[model samples]
Target: MSPRPSSPTIPEGRDSDGVDFRNVVGILARRRNWVFGVPLALCALVVAYLLVAHPAYTGTAQVFVDPRDQYTPKDDPLQNSVPGDGLLLVESQLKIITSNEVLNRVIEQMNLQNDPEFNGERVGLGRLVKALIGLGKPEDRALVTLRNLRKKVTTRRIDRSFVIDILASADTAPRAAALANAVATSYLEEQAGANSAFQRRTSEAISAQLGKLRQEVKRGEEAVAAYKAANNLVGARSRMVSEQQLDEANTQLTNAKTRLADAQARVRLIETIEHGDAGLDAVPEAMQSAAIVQLRGRLADASREEAQLAQIDGPNHPALQAARAQVRDVQAAIQRELKTIARSVRNTYASERTNVQTLQANFDALKTQSQANEKLLVPLRELERKAESSRIVYESFLAKAKTAEERQGIDTTNIRLISRATTPENKSWPPAMIMLAAAIFAGLTIGIALALARDYFDRQDRGPEPDAVAEPDVPARAAAEPAPAFRPAVIAQHHAGRLSALSEDLLAAPQGHTMVLVQVQRAAWLDDVALQLARAVIANEMDVMLVDADLARHRTTSRLGFDKAPGLRDVMAGIAAINEVVQLHKPTAMRIVPVGLSAVAERDPRARQALSLAFRQLRDFDRVIVDGGEMGSTASEFGLYYLADEVVFLAQGPGGKSEDAAILVDLLKLRQVKARVVFVEPDVSVAA
Candidate 1:
């Protein structure tokens, strides 16, 4: 057997089969017409459009958005529904300026439907073409005219302010200006009308409420009056008659108490004089007796006469005896008068006591009546308070109703036209300069894309070389040791079974060999190819190991439903023993290692270095088949290329010849790495 070539690494640009930027620039230069002409042609078209399109003149009018009567503590309900702050209010007002109400007014005022700019007049070649095609109709024209009129009217709000601009476009400058002014005027009028209507409604509501409140006040006043009458609480200035009566009763009670004490003292004094040893002469009653006084005076006179008689005549003389008798008679008369005085004093005491009892009784009865009246006054006073409150509420509502009625006829719109629209001097739509720049930019971009696409297709048509060579698909890696040159072993469809044919190619190689199975194009039956190869190995009665290296789409693992099973990632991360994760394919009894989700394992720098050891461990098996993901792009597959002894390319059919695989083959040949190809054709059977 010929000596195996050393594996090659990716080469620098000019020395290997790879696309270079210099070549891409050259291809663009050759197709200069496509790159430059497209942009110029597009710019010409933009000029043509500007010339043929009817110029639309635009006019603008400015208005303030402040609501009227800000100090009234009332809000415009319609305005309040819109947001209140900064951009939101501005945006809402902008919508209102373009509202149907305002626009319809503008449309009617300008008679835009009859205007040619809006009504679709047949002016140019396009109109003639449409007429020839039988596309233009009167009804369609009316609808289109209305739609165009609406589209021509636009509004914008000035930033950081409460100003909105109403803009209208028309065929003539004066017409556009008139339409704009009309729209602004109509909006202002509508706003004023709305405010007036709102106030009218508000006044109506307040009037209704005022009527109810008036009835309430009347009822409250009536209740207060009825309570006052029922309780007999007639008085001056909030004080009731019963309260004054109570005061009078208290004063009488105090006076009666004083009188009763005085009467009792007098009665006791009289009793002392009559029943005790006190003298009648010492008594005030005896001192005031007229009969007693007379008796005393007479006794004194008779005593003096008896003294004169005794001195001149005998003791038993008739004149002296008469004097003595006269004195005794006077003394007896004085005694009778004292008894009469005592009886009269007792009678006076009894009469005074009776008067005191009558006064006390009268005072007590008045006091009881006053206290009972006081209890009734509580609810009556409450009724009075309610009456006052209802009166106050009624007055307040009446005042508000009057205010509302006064404001009902007042228009409260603050929206004023700051600037009226004037005739536009120039057209607004189809800005010449901006359209030209945009056309140039867009044309350049499309032109460049087409140029690159054309170059790529041309390269593809040229195809790869007939002689196969191993090449690197990855970026060039620095050489550690010089590598030998190698030849490629290209495999095509054979009469033998593709699987059995692949098996023979491997069996013919040195024993216990490792190879990477890569598809020339993606999704070229990679899983089916891997399975068939495993079965071929099993048929030969040799143990084989299948390592699924495809992390993107784990076709091998999914087909066998071993998605969750531990496989390449687990082994690489040292989380599982190789034997534990390796599942045996029952049909072929082949050992298959699944590719699990091991992002951390693939990211580690040590994972690639550990591959040699992993391959050595699998030396016990007769063969190791690694599903080396995609051909050119996968970094893991590029690393696997160095670890495997040889590489096998699986092409789907005649259409499966990828330029990427060709480049990779050339890179492999430069490094002297053994590589081969296996073509898989559809609807054909092969033998072993």
Candidate 2:
């Protein structure tokens, strides 16, 4: 036989197989009445709400931000370091604006809590009902009141500017403006006062430090003065002059004493000559000269030796004896010579003695003068001490005076206000147009979803109702001839027997030769019937096979706890050989051959043609229970009706009075199917 042609492809835009934009438009057009009505009604409601809603006026004040306020300048002497951007200051200000301190002040100033309208005004019964239904809460009433008041008060940064816009709203415009202005003024005053306090404290601290510094300066000056006074430091020039005069006088006195001693020595020599030393002339000039020369040489040698031995020997060494003897000889010779000379020069000697006496008197006078000069040093030292004291006092007082002068200059001026708050003129709220547009869009989207969902759940098939015979695309040879009619008398007798006898008769059919047919009024009822029949057939102890003929909704395998298997559909399509697709249910002693398990067949036109071939291959089972599609469904009427030998129509008593059942019966008769209709009654006793 020639293979059947492939199923026709569903055209794009076709309503049956793809999204129908036209249907979508039609649904939307149909719902247009509600669409327009809902929005218009909502718009009216909004308008009514606005009309009844309390009128709120807003007032605003401009505040300039001072970023520098929270920071200390680098040059500021008293400032200490802190972290973060000065934005912290702005944040602090924001907190203060919303603080309980500010809020309480506003409440008290406006007498808001006591004002009935601003508190809890009477609410209508409609609002009460909405509140009970959770559409509203009583807390919302309080919030609304607060919001209404809040509307009279708002603070925002001005666009692209550091200034803040403080706005207020109220039932009365003036009050709203006033409240806003008041809050702004209060905040500004508070900030200004804080700044003033900070400045005052800083100034006071500086003042105290300055006072301490001044006292320190004074004490430092006094210390310097006392030090100078104690040290007796006269002016440098005066001290130098006095020291020069004292040195000059001492030099003169030393010179005078030297002359006086020279004169006295000469007189002593003259006296020795006059005392009978005329005989000294008898001595040899050479001897006298030699003696004097020797003594002088010896003394010179001894002094030189003594100087060299000063560190190692005493002045009394025996080496000095020759010098002493030589000195004595020289003296005796000098005395003799002097006596001889003196006899010849008595007048000269006497004159020498007078000069010596005069010289001694002058030496005494010089010594006295030196003593008097040394005495003057005490008074000069005293004057130096006094001068040093005065200089010290002057320096100390001068240093203190300079420090005090610097301290007194730290007064400065009071901190000044750099900016003032200004009242604002406009209100911000509602966003009516945007909200309405969003609502309309949401409503339409919801409406479309509901329509599609309704269509999806409806069970009616759309077109080309199921017919008795396969379509012309299927080969005639693949179609089965009508089954031979069974005697109604024989079936009725079998049905009237005891349930156990019926079971025995079914089981007695040759071990591998049995057939069970189940028909239902609709495709959805098959699962329950198939399960019941499957259980019953398995209980007969004959191997059973079940076939699902409902291509539109193939669920038999799933219900039998099998995943989709390539069964009857593949055999009919010639894609799979029969034995390969036929799955055996081992534990139950049953085999299940489901109809087309391919999800594709539901929309394929050749599905019925393929199903007819699948049913032809089912003769191998010992007993076959076919779960054909619903009697009224197209798949059963055209694809499965001729395949069954004996068919049973499943109904539910008077509940099966729908036109669907009547049409199914007529279709079965028209197809010449030898089927018996059975009504199922609910067993109340078993159900309970």
Candidate 3:
């Protein structure tokens, strides 16, 4: 056996595949015409479209939406029960702007059905295409045209405002503006017509109600008149007669009673004065009499003259006697006047008592008559109240009816055409440079997708992968020879330089050791590489043990033509001993282990330990080469890497997927496994 050398360190430059700028440049350079031509062609087509395309002009008209005030009842309790927000009303009006009724009117007024552009029957590329496809039918053409016309006319409500912008587009500058203005005007006319009709109907209803109310008022007044006539009550004063007479009677009775009380008091005073207990000066009536006052004055003069005579004249003098006689005559006159006044007061007292009795009797009779009249007037008063209420209602309805009739003649609309649409100054669509740029970008994207798709399909139809099928009849001597002799012509030429470089380093590796060949990429061709390495070891006259560790697809075993042979899988599963699966290569005379179909070998807990023990048994051979399919792709492959002395990772080239290999390398390093990477280029010679 040869002495084993120290483990080899993979050079940093050769650790994993790196980016090859040359490869990308070669791809683009090979398809240079396609890369440049597609975008330019598309840009030219777009420029042609912009130049020759029919330019459309857009026109806009602005209209204001004014919400009409809803008639609110002044005394109704339910006026606020429903939603009356003007926002909702405004929104409703906005919807009505685009309604079928309004649009139909606009269409009729503009005579748009005869217009080819609005009817969708205009001569154009789309129409020609549809004609060729036999799609345009005459029966549905009107509907289709109407639908298309509606699309051209759009109404937009200004944000947070009640203004709406009506936009219309057409082939001609004036037509676009005309259509916009026509739609707005038609909407306004429709609203006004609707309001006028409503007012007319309302006026008719009010007139009918007013007629009924007038009849009711007339009937009520007639009934009240008849009631008065039937009771012989005349004039407006008739109803108030009983009440007025009772009031007057009460007043008269009260005055007469006052007079009677005064008269009685006067009579008492007169009687007292006449009895001589009190003087007649105490009588109010006598004092008030001018005759009594005159008599008293005369008596006062006589008393004074008498007092003078008594003071100055002799006892029997003639002047003294005459003064005495004058005083006596004045006293007699005053007494006679007081007695006459007292008798007249008594007569007035009796007369006043009789008058008070008559007034009291009249008041009582008037009160009785008023109470009876009040009872008779109860139903009449109710009829009067009803008549008054009906009259008021009738007057209100008459006023309302007059107003509605006046409004019916007047045309009014809440919507106003604040601004009319005008002829467009410039084309609204197909900005030349911008459209050209977009077309160029789209063309480039489409070109790239086509290129990638062509490449993918070409690869798919390029027959099966060279390494996908296993070779069951290749002689062992073919593998032991140089790559050109046994490998396929495609692989030999492409991998010649890489295999040559790898051979020198691999041949210098120490003998009597295990080598694990693992492919980190999915569905790789690492097994073929392992076969070549095994053959090379055998060529050195060493006893090589080639173990087909990949049980899933026994590529090595197939190449060796030992499918029926017991192999490593049997030994791992404890179904067969290690010695039982070992066989010698036909031409190379090297020991080989075929992969047998053994179930549960992967799930065996002691599979790794058993594989390690199997490796130890293989130590007697000059070298052991295990084919581990893919490292992360299979779980059983990890045990082979642990059992091997050195691991070779085969990576596919021309891709930036080194991260996957790097992760595997890190994992292997953690397990204390030494790994080296070998990059195999698929189209290396073609690229070159």
Highest TM-score: which candidate? 3
- What is the TM-score (0 to 1) of candidate 2? 0.38
Give the lDDT ranking, best first: 3, 1, 2
What are the per-residue Cα lDDT tens digits for candidate 3 across 1-688? 5655443332332222221223234334545666677888998888888877888889999988766533423324344233544567667776787777887887788787787887777798887888899986675655665687688788887888878898988888898999889888888888888889998999999998887899999998888878877765544623566777888899888889998999998888777667778788788877798998898888888889888888998869999899888988888888888888878888899899999888888888888877887877887788788888888999899888887887786754556889999998987776776888788888877766665455435434223446544342243332235443224433333343446555555566667567777664543234467766666766667677888877666667877778887787778787888998889776667678888767643345577557767887887776778887654434343355556677776766534333445555566676567766767655331110
Each prediction's number of clashing residue pairs: 17, 23, 0
How well is each residue in 1-688 modelled by candidate 2, as lDDT tens digits?
A: 2232232232334223111233345445544665565656666766666566655566666676655533322234334223454455555566666555565566667677666555655465556778788886455544555544554566665455445666666656567667776677666655565555655565565555555555655665465455445545323434433345446555655665565565555455555544754534333332456654565565576556556665455557554554455556665665654454445445544555566566556656656655664465455556555556555655554554544344333322222223333343443344466657766776556656755554334434222323232211122231122212222212122222213332344455443332333443332322345544555557655456677665555555655555566876666555776677877666555677766454434435355555545555555555566765544343443435455554555554433222334344455455554445555322110100
Residue 23 miss distance in model 2 (angstroms): 9.0
Each candidate's TM vs. the true structure?
A: 0.52, 0.38, 0.58
Candidate 1 C-alpha error for residue 362, in Å: 7.9
lDDT of 1 at 459: 39
Give the residue spans of candidate 1 off by over 4 A: 1-69, 72-100, 108-185, 204-233, 245-390, 408-514, 521-612, 616-638, 648-656, 667-688
- For model 2 the local lDDT of residue 377 reads 47
Which is the leading candidate under lDDT?
Answer: 3
Q: Rate the local accuracy (lDDT) of all candidates.
A: 0.68, 0.50, 0.70
TM-score, prediction 1: 0.52
Worst 10 residues of 1 by lDDT: 486-495
lDDT of 3 at 18: 21
